[model samples]
Target: MMLVFALMLCVPAFACLAMAMERHQETLFGALLSAAASRVLRCAGWSALFVALWLAVAGKGWALGLVWYSGCTSLGAGIVYGLLIVFAKRMSAR
Candidate 1:
Protein backbone atom coordinates (compact mmCIF):
# COMPACT_ATOMS: atom_id res chain seq x y z
CA MET A 1 0.00 0.00 0.00
CA MET A 2 2.76 2.41 0.91
CA LEU A 3 4.56 1.62 -2.28
CA VAL A 4 1.45 2.22 -4.29
CA PHE A 5 0.65 5.47 -2.53
CA ALA A 6 4.20 6.65 -2.87
CA LEU A 7 4.20 5.95 -6.55
CA MET A 8 0.68 7.23 -7.12
CA LEU A 9 1.17 10.37 -5.10
CA CYS A 10 4.70 11.29 -4.11
CA VAL A 11 6.49 10.37 -7.30
CA PRO A 12 4.16 12.37 -9.49
CA ALA A 13 3.66 15.09 -6.92
CA PHE A 14 7.35 15.80 -6.87
CA ALA A 15 7.63 15.37 -10.57
CA CYS A 16 4.78 17.80 -10.95
CA LEU A 17 6.53 20.21 -8.68
CA ALA A 18 9.73 19.93 -10.63
CA MET A 19 7.76 20.38 -13.79
CA ALA A 20 6.00 23.31 -12.19
CA MET A 21 9.41 24.88 -11.74
CA GLU A 22 9.76 24.70 -15.47
CA ARG A 23 6.08 25.75 -15.77
CA HIS A 24 3.51 22.97 -16.00
CA GLN A 25 -0.20 22.72 -15.27
CA GLU A 26 -2.71 19.86 -15.00
CA THR A 27 -6.43 19.57 -14.23
CA LEU A 28 -7.73 18.15 -10.98
CA PHE A 29 -9.67 15.52 -12.88
CA GLY A 30 -6.49 14.46 -14.56
CA ALA A 31 -4.69 14.08 -11.28
CA LEU A 32 -7.55 12.07 -9.82
CA LEU A 33 -7.66 9.72 -12.76
CA SER A 34 -3.92 9.36 -12.74
CA ALA A 35 -3.85 8.52 -9.05
CA ALA A 36 -6.70 6.07 -9.37
CA ALA A 37 -5.25 4.21 -12.32
CA SER A 38 -1.82 4.10 -10.79
CA ARG A 39 -3.27 2.62 -7.66
CA VAL A 40 -5.00 -0.07 -9.64
CA LEU A 41 -1.93 -1.00 -11.60
CA ARG A 42 0.29 -0.94 -8.59
CA CYS A 43 -2.18 -3.24 -6.93
CA ALA A 44 -2.01 -5.68 -9.79
CA GLY A 45 1.75 -5.66 -9.96
CA TRP A 46 2.11 -6.15 -6.24
CA SER A 47 -0.56 -8.75 -6.32
CA ALA A 48 1.57 -10.58 -8.81
CA LEU A 49 4.63 -10.17 -6.66
CA PHE A 50 2.74 -11.33 -3.64
CA VAL A 51 1.61 -14.36 -5.49
CA ALA A 52 5.12 -15.06 -6.59
CA LEU A 53 6.45 -14.72 -3.09
CA TRP A 54 3.76 -16.98 -1.78
CA LEU A 55 4.62 -19.52 -4.36
CA ALA A 56 8.29 -19.27 -3.50
CA VAL A 57 7.63 -19.71 0.19
CA ALA A 58 5.56 -22.74 -0.72
CA GLY A 59 8.44 -23.88 -2.96
CA LYS A 60 6.41 -23.35 -6.08
CA GLY A 61 7.04 -19.73 -7.01
CA TRP A 62 10.22 -20.71 -8.75
CA ALA A 63 9.05 -22.35 -11.89
CA LEU A 64 10.26 -22.53 -15.41
CA GLY A 65 7.69 -20.04 -16.65
CA LEU A 66 6.68 -18.16 -13.51
CA VAL A 67 9.90 -16.15 -13.47
CA TRP A 68 9.01 -14.33 -16.60
CA TYR A 69 5.35 -14.55 -15.67
CA SER A 70 5.89 -11.93 -13.03
CA GLY A 71 6.71 -9.49 -15.75
CA CYS A 72 3.34 -10.25 -17.26
CA THR A 73 1.74 -8.20 -14.55
CA SER A 74 1.62 -4.58 -15.51
CA LEU A 75 1.44 -1.48 -13.46
CA GLY A 76 -1.18 0.42 -15.40
CA ALA A 77 0.15 3.26 -17.52
CA GLY A 78 -3.16 5.10 -17.16
CA ILE A 79 -1.80 6.84 -14.10
CA VAL A 80 0.93 8.69 -15.93
CA TYR A 81 -1.44 9.23 -18.81
CA GLY A 82 -4.05 10.88 -16.63
CA LEU A 83 -1.39 12.79 -14.81
CA LEU A 84 -0.20 13.99 -18.16
CA ILE A 85 -3.58 15.62 -18.77
CA VAL A 86 -3.40 17.58 -15.56
CA PHE A 87 0.20 18.39 -16.29
CA ALA A 88 -0.77 19.61 -19.71
CA LYS A 89 -3.09 22.15 -18.16
CA ARG A 90 -0.38 23.33 -15.84
CA MET A 91 2.08 23.76 -18.65
CA SER A 92 -0.48 25.58 -20.78
CA ALA A 93 -1.27 28.01 -17.98
CA ARG A 94 2.27 29.24 -18.29
Candidate 2:
Protein backbone atom coordinates (compact mmCIF):
# COMPACT_ATOMS: atom_id res chain seq x y z
CA MET A 1 0.00 0.00 0.00
CA MET A 2 2.71 2.45 0.94
CA LEU A 3 4.69 1.50 -2.12
CA VAL A 4 1.69 2.11 -4.29
CA PHE A 5 1.18 5.53 -2.79
CA ALA A 6 4.82 6.35 -3.29
CA LEU A 7 4.61 5.24 -6.92
CA MET A 8 1.57 7.41 -7.53
CA LEU A 9 3.24 10.46 -6.06
CA CYS A 10 6.45 9.78 -7.92
CA VAL A 11 4.88 9.62 -11.39
CA PRO A 12 3.41 13.10 -11.20
CA ALA A 13 6.48 14.41 -9.47
CA PHE A 14 8.62 13.25 -12.35
CA ALA A 15 6.15 14.64 -14.83
CA CYS A 16 6.32 18.03 -13.17
CA LEU A 17 10.10 17.93 -13.22
CA ALA A 18 10.22 17.01 -16.89
CA MET A 19 7.70 19.57 -17.94
CA ALA A 20 9.65 22.22 -16.09
CA MET A 21 12.27 22.03 -18.79
CA GLU A 22 11.90 24.38 -21.76
CA ARG A 23 12.51 21.56 -24.22
CA HIS A 24 9.83 19.39 -22.70
CA GLN A 25 7.44 22.32 -22.32
CA GLU A 26 6.86 22.62 -26.04
CA THR A 27 6.57 18.88 -26.48
CA LEU A 28 4.11 18.45 -23.65
CA PHE A 29 2.18 21.72 -23.72
CA GLY A 30 2.60 22.66 -27.39
CA ALA A 31 4.27 25.92 -26.34
CA LEU A 32 7.12 27.09 -24.21
CA LEU A 33 6.22 28.18 -20.74
CA SER A 34 7.17 31.53 -19.25
CA ALA A 35 10.19 31.68 -16.97
CA ALA A 36 7.97 32.23 -13.97
CA ALA A 37 5.83 29.20 -14.79
CA SER A 38 8.88 27.05 -15.30
CA ARG A 39 10.24 28.15 -11.96
CA VAL A 40 7.01 27.24 -10.23
CA LEU A 41 6.88 23.83 -11.85
CA ARG A 42 10.47 23.19 -10.92
CA CYS A 43 9.84 24.11 -7.33
CA ALA A 44 6.66 22.07 -7.15
CA GLY A 45 8.37 19.10 -8.70
CA TRP A 46 11.18 19.12 -6.14
CA SER A 47 8.79 19.65 -3.28
CA ALA A 48 6.55 16.78 -4.38
CA LEU A 49 9.54 14.49 -4.74
CA PHE A 50 10.63 15.40 -1.23
CA VAL A 51 7.16 14.69 0.09
CA ALA A 52 7.14 11.33 -1.62
CA LEU A 53 10.46 10.51 -0.03
CA TRP A 54 9.10 11.50 3.35
CA LEU A 55 6.02 9.37 2.85
CA ALA A 56 8.13 6.38 1.94
CA VAL A 57 10.51 6.81 4.83
CA ALA A 58 7.74 7.35 7.32
CA GLY A 59 5.69 4.40 6.16
CA LYS A 60 8.56 1.95 6.12
CA GLY A 61 11.92 1.59 7.81
CA TRP A 62 14.83 3.69 6.52
CA ALA A 63 16.57 1.01 4.45
CA LEU A 64 13.44 -0.41 2.88
CA GLY A 65 11.98 3.03 2.26
CA LEU A 66 15.10 4.22 0.45
CA VAL A 67 14.99 1.15 -1.72
CA TRP A 68 11.36 1.72 -2.53
CA TYR A 69 12.06 5.40 -3.35
CA SER A 70 14.85 4.45 -5.73
CA GLY A 71 12.59 2.05 -7.62
CA CYS A 72 9.75 4.53 -7.68
CA THR A 73 11.97 7.32 -8.98
CA SER A 74 13.40 5.16 -11.75
CA LEU A 75 10.00 3.83 -12.81
CA GLY A 76 8.44 7.25 -12.66
CA ALA A 77 11.19 8.80 -14.76
CA GLY A 78 10.89 6.03 -17.34
CA ILE A 79 7.16 6.50 -17.53
CA VAL A 80 7.55 10.25 -18.05
CA TYR A 81 10.19 9.74 -20.70
CA GLY A 82 7.95 7.32 -22.58
CA LEU A 83 5.05 9.70 -22.50
CA LEU A 84 7.17 12.62 -23.67
CA ILE A 85 8.42 10.66 -26.63
CA VAL A 86 4.94 9.58 -27.56
CA PHE A 87 3.58 13.07 -27.32
CA ALA A 88 6.43 14.53 -29.27
CA LYS A 89 5.96 12.00 -32.04
CA ARG A 90 2.23 12.52 -32.12
CA MET A 91 2.62 16.28 -32.43
CA SER A 92 5.19 15.94 -35.16
CA ALA A 93 2.95 13.58 -37.11
CA ARG A 94 0.21 16.14 -37.25
Question: Can you give the TM-score per candidate against the true fold?
Answer: 0.29, 0.93
The best candidate in terms of lDDT = 2
lDDT of 1 by residue, 1-94 (tens): 3333323443343333333322232243333335555555456555545554444334433573344333322222345455667767676697
Candidate 2 deviant stretches above 4 angstroms: none
Worst-scoring 10-residue span by lDDT in model 1: 68-77
How does model 1 score by TM-score?
Answer: 0.29
Clashing pairs in 1: 24-90, 24-91, 25-89, 25-90, 25-91, 26-86, 26-87, 26-90, 27-86, 55-61
- The regions of model 1 sitting more than 4 angstroms off are 1-33, 60-94
Q: Report, for every candidate in turn, its global Cα lDDT versus the true structure.
A: 0.42, 0.88
